[model samples]
Target chain A: MANHAISACAPDASIESYIRHYAQCIDISLKQALASSNAHPKLLEAMEYSLMAGGKRLRPILMIAAAESLGAELERIMPVACAVEMIHSYSLVHDDLPAMDDDDYRRGKLTNHKVYGEAMAILAGDGLLTHAFYMATLAAGSDAVSLQRLMLVIREMAALAGIAGMVAGQAADMEGEQGITSLEQLESIHLRKTGDLIVFALRAGGRLSGASEAQLKALESYGYGIGLAFQIQDDILDITGDPAKTGKAANSDERAGKVTYPYFLGMDESRRKMHELTESAKQAVQQAGLPDPQRLLQLADYLMQRDR
Target chain B: MANHAISACAPDASIESYIRHYAQCIDISLKQALASSNAHPKLLEAMEYSLMAGGKRLRPILMIAAAESLGAELERIMPVACAVEMIHSYSLVHDDLPAMDDDDYRRGKLTNHKVYGEAMAILAGDGLLTHAFYMATLAAGSDAVSLQRLMLVIREMAALAGIAGMVAGQAADMEGEQGITSLEQLESIHLRKTGDLIVFALRAGGRLSGASEAQLKALESYGYGIGLAFQIQDDILDITGDPAKTGKAANSDERAGKVTYPYFLGMDESRRKMHELTESAKQAVQQAGLPDPQRLLQLADYLMQRDR
Candidate 1:
């Protein structure tokens, strides 16, 4: 009964429209979540500064699309979607701190610490990260997902984003800043830092939407393929894309002496690798037997073709 | 049937022995949790440095005692207990950061950033915080606690420990360091910072133990009373306790010019308030219809008299 209802409601909109629609929905949810916080105005300001800053809302959109493609109601998964975006925003805030990336700007504007001071920015990031669990748990109230499923989502999300996953990847990346230049090392770092959370987002959607085992396997493959492709594109953009388009300083990776896919694989090979990954991602979606896999396929192509 | 079984097995050990036993159990769980993580040895090292550096495992111990007082199985609640301690440890790591309290040492050892560098210390804190939710969700597997109940615990724990609670209090405290001194403001900060999580620990135990509504309410009152008393005692100790015994510099709060109960109410009055709070805590616990409330009462008295 649940599967039948979900299949019947599979997204009928175009991929672009689907993304835009869900992005707006997620933005509203994020806004509502933050708006209820009035205890610390400055902390909230710092959090909102980064959270509300314009971006593609990619993580949450991916989560929504992943679920909706399986015919699950997007509304039932908004809390989880918002939570992922919150996690992503918190990571960016911390990454741009003086002790880390030390960037002054993000998303074409001043970074959180640049605007809120280091202490407030750190607290803002902490606030976002902690609140994210609260937000994700909100999904337990939805009729579309069971309590057991939400618990699994919480556990999986934590593992993916915690010590053994994103945090581990981040630690390695920071340690690597002293000049580890191997492609395998960089890929290892990227897999944890970038891939795990992205993969978890899709898997969470599948888990919540009750996707079949085969469908989940396909989503995992799709997630890994696009996660790698996304990082490669980011590296390529750092070297070749315009600052205006990318919303970041062009060639900054080279300036920082950071190892990147382009540097390790060479630009031609990097582009080819990204293309192959994108193809694999599209194929994974195709083979998943989703009622409507159009949005995911187009999303992969869009990610690949993006200049930013 | 559950209530009958729990009441039959209520703890008969002395408070000291009870606490010692549960503390050892919590330490073992914490060690096993960290031991399983092989990724980023340095980050784990930094986390372990603080986690194992040793203070009384007050939060987790409180949780264990709370459950045991009601005759609930302590093993069934260990995950939530360990998670609370993890949250406490993470907060300490971040609080000691150069950007925050700028403390050089904690628990008589070098702070995380001092030993692991600023970036790795930050990641270690993040890793612990994120891992906490993962740990708490492990409670879902226990037959003693239903999945829905565990979800509620996660949500409540996150809220109490997250933005609107500890983080908000820390932010306020940080902002207050610039010279806001008032008893009300101090209490407000202490209530959110110290009180909420302590209250949460007790309530989570109660919830998992299936305490009646009246018992949970009594626990809340007991928690707030002890929480306030705990902070007041801490303030008093900072001014008068020996640094060797306290494991932190005596009079550091005074030197930092941070506001404290003693600062606003005088040392004698602070002592009076601490005694009052402790009495209130004991009274609340006694009023609670717990199977064995002696441990909680003794714990309150112990907290009030502790030099460290």
Candidate 2:
């Protein structure tokens, strides 16, 4: 997997350096997005704590990179990038609530609810979710993107993150936790829960960057293939990856009796499926005829092989 | 108060009839907004439970009436009306969670968490909030309202309902719950928590209807005045109104030991202040030079005299 990632990026620097650079860019934008609003101090504090807590920031990077692949300036789409990350962070905070997953820790730090009280945590999540739309409204225009296109991006982002999308996936996941026994049911949960937002991020980037309908269709296919692979890799890592590397306890899913890709398919079959999906994702990007698909291809490989 | 309300409506029908008619319009719109989504049945069930559970539909009615007073067709801005109500309902669901106000009932029905369980209730709120932006994007255009104007309404709605507005107010109210004593502090909380959204509803209606700068200013002042009066009356009702009429327990605010207008000011002083504010609100609407300010004037009077 590492060899494939390196070979995919041989024409440029390694995927590691690219991810690091984009991650730093995302961090700065996220901070600026949350900066010193006149909002209540404690609420801002809670929002900042979860937002600033480190993660791969993979979603925003994919958004920016996707736009960049289509020849758009990074600054033009920074707000959309930050908005997606804000939505992601808010979901995490709510997911960790006592009434939800009841998680005590996340990304090696105390969960939002563990540090802030449950009420504050809930409000923090609410604030972040509302502010994501507020941030998206700030997505300014350039030669490549019109305000109408930006509005379309905002509309699509909201839909993908909304009830029929991410929230739907979450609701289904909560319901399925009582014992989802079929692979189809598991896929249904993963598709809505994880796939829709990933597709939105890529499609939003494409739409904002003036991709043709055909190109956007290719990106949609690419996003779906990789989204499923990503979740399967997550499931595999839960069983085999080191806790220190994964930022979560190993075998926890099994202990909780949660149905996952590996649990349904076996570790070897899950790995095989992930590899096939990654190949398809890369092929989709290649077929899109984008000016620069190398970075996305490398991203697909990197996601499949990441230790953490 | 009753005499003032009757006199204010002498130019038209009673405000009570106007409210009932507009309330039905809002109910139909709200129902349409929530219909036929492919979201999880349980999640949608929870959202619909809180959303369709009856309230006065006051905010949406105010928005529609304010727009209609300026001669904008109600159908043109129905999306904004429904969106505002969605935001309102989402807040109530989250606020009634055990981690927040912990209420068992709302609008005479079981609170969302009480029926759906906490995790589902939280997801339900998240779903409705996101779905509101989705619904707003669906606001169809007409010859009278431009897309830009509709976008502005959506942007302002999100801002007012987001951090630094309603969410900020909620955070402050939560913080202030630990025995806030000053009248100024209490006023600050009320302005953000309850007042901003109310103001947004009125301003949204005016903006969508192409109100002049002078008229917009009048609506702004009118919103602030009535927003305060609305809360003051709510506080007074908590102390004196019948539970059956209010659909909530009497004196619950006092029992909760939360700060309120009447808690800081004497009942007579609070009543006097509410009356004064209501008069100012009516005057502002009257001064706006709208074609039909009678409904708005009567609304101001009716809000002050409402028993629930």
Interface RMSD of each: 2.6, 3.2
Per-prediction DockQ, in order? 0.61, 0.48
In model 2, the runs with Cα more than 4 Å from the true position are: A1-11, A140-145, B1-13, B140-145
Residue B27, model 1: lDDT of 75
* Tens digit per residue, CA lDDT, model 2, B1-308: 01111111123557787787777777776776677566778899999999988878888878877887897766667777778888999999999999998999777778999988999999999999998887776663532236566666777887789889898888888888786879998888888888888988998888888898798888888888999999999999988999889876888887777778888888999999999998988898888899877678878889998998
- lDDT, candidate 1, A140-254, per-residue tens: 8533247777888899899989898899999988988887768888888988998988988998888899888798889889988999999999999998999888977889988
Q: lDDT per residue, candidate 1, B1-308, as tens digits?
A: 11221222225666667667667677778888888756578888888888887758888878877887798876668788889999999999999999999999777788889988999889989998998898898877533246767888898888999888999999998888887767898898888888989989999998898888898888889999999999999999998998888886879888877778888899999999999988988888887879978778889998888887
Instruction: DockQ for candidate 1, please give it.
Output: 0.61
Model 2 reproduces what portion of true contacts?
A: 0.67
Pairs that collide, model 2: none
- Candidate 1: where are CA atoms >4 Å away? A1-13, A141-145, B1-12, B142-145
Error of 1 at A138 (Å): 0.7
